[model samples]
Target: MSEDPASSRQSSRNQDKTWINRLMSGFSSEPKSREDLINIIKEAAANQLLDDEAVSMIEGAIDVHERQVREVMVPRSQMVVIGIEETPEQLLPTVIESAHSRFPVIGESADDIKGILLAKDLLPLILNGTEDFTLEKVIRPASIIPESKRLNVLLREFRENRYHMALVIDEYGAIAGLVTIEDVLEKIVGDIEDETDEEDEDGFIRKVSDNEYVIKALLPIDQFNDEFGAKFDDNEFDTIAGILIRAFGHLPSRNEHVEIDGFEFRVLYADSRQIHLIRLTIPES
Candidate 1:
């Protein structure tokens, strides 16, 4: 005899309810702290109740609540800005080389930010000709935000206002850095690859100059050794980040540097959880 589909569906719903009830029962009391909540979620994953991705995302969401804009912002020194007085011909190379959709347009100084310029807004000028191009006519209002703003609050504003970028200002109202919607989302989820990201081995380690390189902390120790020709012991730690964390004896914050075997590893981006990016400087032989 064939089983009834309706009966099967009802049975499946009952099973799901039972599983949920069992999971809820395990949390006998409310989680006292974020760490406790994370521990419970991790235990649930260990027991096959929740998946690894779900646990990671939950932890990330909690992390966002504690982080500030300054922690994840692109530092002012690393920001690529377009001078307000620059002609279309002069800015085209910067626009093409940086491959960024939006740029902060500056006036007399870097602190004197005028407005934000969209790359697409310049297409008409390129098509028609730069003979009549005026930056003020094309630039849009800049979204200014404070460096101390929490990431959760910033993310909400980004969604509600439909703005992708914001200029971060310090206590003195100077341009400290810039933050984007992608930067906030990356905290919740993992890295989101865009068109500009290279898909080759060089993608993990990008050369900034003859002595400096930008590297992803997730890059394997073996791959790092292959690139730099260093003899790092990969047996103890799988990734270079692990080795660095061990060397630091604690989680390192952004801009923190440590020297090992004459190589300088400077933290480019990191949170309470782990390091994301690092800048490597090779000592001259």
Candidate 2:
């Protein structure tokens, strides 16, 4: 006789609940704070009741509640935007070069954001005819949000509204930056590499330009030195992130940069615990 799948699933769920209850039973009282709860979870992981990835995800979920949109948004200066007055020929190169799915369409300046232009929306114009193409016709209404909005709330809104991108504004209603669904999700589950991310075969580093590169914080200091022709001490710190953290004296936030030995190291992606990725800009010799 074949085993019942439903019964097997129920047994598995019951076993999971039993272990979870056992883990909680060790606590004399309910967790008094988030930190205490996290400590309990860490203990469970240490005891083999929970895995490392599960602990990380739970911590990330808690961290999201404490973070605001401003913490993870791509700054206005780095935003790749399309001018409303730009022609198809002019904007195509930007769309292709940036490799971004959505771009904010600006009217006069970066402050005067009109709407969002999706790269896929241009397919029909390219195939049919460009003569009838106008950015005003294909642009979608942009979602506006404040920089102070919390990540958890933003994630809920993103799911409920079915939109991916939002323009973040400051107290004065000026565009501060932009945040995406991926950015918020990354806070919970860590980095989500898409097809657009062009990295080396080892996935440790990606050259952005002649003098700039995006690198994983886990890249060994020895390999980094060999790649960049710079001598950084690896005896004290194994990875570039260790050297950076020593220089920073604390866990740095996204977009924060520090110059060490003529090399500009900027935090690209990081959370409460540690830095994940960085942008390295080599100085001209």
**Candidate number of the best lDDT:** 2
lDDT of each: 0.89, 0.91
TM-score per candidate, chains pooled? 0.81, 0.77
Compared with the true structure, what per-residue lDDT tens digits does model 2 show for residues 55-101?
Answer: 99999999999999988898786799999999999999999999999
Q: Lowest lDDT 10-mer window, candidate 2?
A: 199-208
Off by over 4 Å in 2: 1-19, 26-28, 200-231, 248-269, 277-285
> Model 1: C-alpha RMSD to truth?
4.1
- lDDT tens per residue, model 1, 72-141: 8997878999999999879999999999999999999889989999999998974798887889999999
Cα RMSD for candidates in order: 4.1, 6.0
